[model samples]
Target: MTDDIDPDEELMLAAEYALGLLAPEEAAAFEQLMARDADFREEYEAWAENLADLTDDIAPVTPPPALLNQIRAAAFGTAAVAAPQPEEVEPPATAPVFETATAQGRGLLQRLGLLPAVGGGLLAALVALWVIDATIGPSLALPTATATLVSEDESLVVEIAYTDDGEWLEFNRRTGRAPEGQDLQLWLINGDRAPISLGVLPAAQTGQLRVPEDYRQLLHGGNCAISVEPLGGSPTGAPTGEVVAIAPIVWET
Candidate 1:
């Protein structure tokens, strides 16, 4: 697909995506094209993470006991299922009774943590090789789910990702590959009333920003947006830009 993106259009889309606010079809379309349009992805990621962070600030009130139980039931189900059994483990053999000189070495070996470690090392290597071959060979593409973030101008890209998991949305203002003086900021919009401030995303070249486990609900449902604001961001809570990219979080199969 043609990437034909303007900084402003992409930014609004990024916010919607980060807010977990996009309709399923819109999100899928973005994800399918993001690789070719990474600028879009990057901005979206930052916005989503930013908003996801704001929701993080509000404490998730504990659902009452009954509600908690109900949630668990809905999540886990009441169907009868067989329990998983533990794998049988063989016990180690008793140490050898050897000559005096050999006995001393064996005694030392037992004292050190080497005997079991050697066997474990071989087992670990085998597992590692198996995992690498299985996971690496398939060439699994980035997730169909995509996230997009934006700068205040709504065009300068910041970060993006392909998962609802907050890892992709964390890139803050490290450096701007865009025009001069434009840095990325993050925000959470209710899409109902207005947007709320989360905080500056982490700088570039850093790892994923942790999703505040606390405000997870916002990531699941809300119209999130990224706007082009000042270098620092809005002094007020409302958005202040051309809205470069946006993505709305919606339920998808």
Candidate 2:
């Protein structure tokens, strides 16, 4: 199989397969070639590993509510499903625990939080092992640290994670939204220093924002606050409106 195709073409095909960008029929053919050619399989695996590195610091994002319907419509050529009214769940009246799942079974964002509501030391150890074995291997340091911000009334909840090496912060807004004509602005509060505006939170539930190299160091041991400001953000270059929620950054170490 390897002899019949040009070496460079085979390498390109391997990369396409690794990225899942090949058409179904072409992918099946590539898989068959991979099974029969040990060298080709190795190339494909290497490509897969290299491509995985590109997303190491990327946070997992929750899909939109209508994504399932769009997927169904695409694959089955069926009409979209009727939207169901979401069941209202009451917020916990007590202090926000910042966790809902067990350490081992949590999703990526929750696992990266290092189990803020649970035993932090144990979960941090477990997560370290998992990250090394599963993703970036041993070459990279633990990629990110996490924190959870909850409003005083627990009406708003957000999970924030930042990577020192990548100089980016990922946010997951678990609940709540900005009030009418207002926006949620994320700010970094480091000691007596004035708050540094990360940016206005997006309407989407989850997203990432780039951080300056100087600001990355401040994320650890510092605090984050979300303030309700005008549509764009605070006009004063600082938090000029009511701060809705604040939380301390929790590092994996």
The digit string of per-residue lDDT tens for model 2 on 1-253 reads: 7668555887788888777676433543454465456687789779868987999899999887556555543333233344332332332245223222112222222222422222233234334434432322223356456767666466677788876677679999988899999999998765435778999999999999788888877675466778889999999998877776655565542
Per-candidate clashes, comma-separated: 49, 0
Candidate 2 weakest ten by summed lDDT: 100-109
Which residue pairs does candidate 2 place in steric collision? none
RMSD of every candidate to native, in Å, equals: 23.4, 22.6
Looking at candidate 1, what is the lDDT of residue 40?
A: 74
- Candidate 2 overall Cα lDDT vs. reference? 0.62
lDDT of each: 0.41, 0.62
**Residue range 20-120, candidate 1, lDDT tens digits:** 46543354334433434667767866765676677777977765544544333223332112322223132213422221211111111122212111123
